[model samples]
Target: MAKHYALASYADGGDWRETEHLYVPRRDTRLRLQSLMALGYTASEVAAATGLSPSHVCNLRTDVVHTTVHVFTADAVASAFRDRWDKLATGPQANRQRSKARRLGYLLPLEWEPGDVDTDDTTEMFLSDPSSPETTENPEVLDYVAIAEAIAGRRVTLTRAELSHAIVTLQDMGVGVHETAERLHTYTRLVNRYRARARQDAA
Candidate 1:
């Protein structure tokens, strides 16, 4: 009797042994997907990069019961993660993705290094990283009242720095000058002045 091996052709047009297609543990792959989502990459973005379905990428990010995945699937996710781990995704969809990941308590890219993703002790290591957002005890709180007054045509008593910070915060949240002025019941000229001051201070 002789040992037998299964063979198949892959997309690269190379015949590979069946052993090469065996499912592998998906812990690292799942973490990588979650980390990318935490960094604001939407499932659709990842799917586009890896040729996986968006729903499949979402499942891999949220599902924990499944313990294994196809080798090719893992490889695709790994390649996508490597290319995007350090980049912060933008746009409404990316913002939603990041919010969902945060609500689900997924680990951030800064929490683990390339080699740490597969290790059981990565959570502990993350806690020790001073630069990690998780370790920030006193994150800067934006001045909501100043922002509200600036938008409502009410007399604002905030300092110059505080008012500038409020304008910048609104800008960062994707609120444009027209919207801010409309909300404040004031002219866009006022909002524009604040925006200009904010930009100058930022630069």
Candidate 2:
């Protein structure tokens, strides 16, 4: 006598169905929740976005749980949070943030005497990097990159301009140039990977 095992059935009866599952671990969800909270989200808001109760969200944020489940709930919540945050961090809102910072003197304007060299040449020299991707200048792309960073436990929420300023500020504060460039390169890779994933998902 011979025995058989159960297998997935295909509608066309030609092959087994191609099955795919999404597993969002408990740790991932907790980290994402904390990242959103640090970005000023309340437990209720996170709960609403995650389809969980406020208390549940709070518990997940504060307590340590180790489990991985196959579902889309956590991923969906993270996606929603990223979309909202990206909107707040880009376009007119981002410009408004810069304006407020300038008004407060946190950022300085470029002032020079009449004898100074052409500003266009200087600006191009300082701002443009031929090796860098053009997408970094787009806030939406930055937001997607930030989502990947947050998942990795580094909750960064800065636009490209802000990040550039931060790197310069760090260098001025005595941070090594090589160190800053290395970190920036890591982030660039993350952004590129996220953009690729977005295109694949859309297709």
Compare the candidates by TM-score and give the number of the best one. Answer: 1
Q: Please report how far candidate 2 places residue 173 from its true position, in Å.
A: 23
**In candidate 2, which residue ranges exceed 4 Å CA deviation?**
1-23, 85-203
State the local distance difference test value for candidate 2. Answer: 0.44
Task: Tell me the tens digit of each residue's lDDT in model 2 across 66-106.
Answer: 57533455544545444343222223344454455345333
Clashes of 2: 0
lDDT of 1 by residue, 19-134 (tens): 54367788878888998888788888899998999999988877889999877787677667655553456547876877888898887765565565554332333334332344
Candidate 2 minimal-lDDT segment of 10 residues: 4-13
Clashing pairs in 2: none
Evaluate candidate 1 by giving its C-alpha RMSD to the native, one decimal: 15.0
Q: Over 4 Å off in model 1, which ranges?
A: 1-21, 113-116, 119-203
lDDT of all the models against the reference?
0.63, 0.44
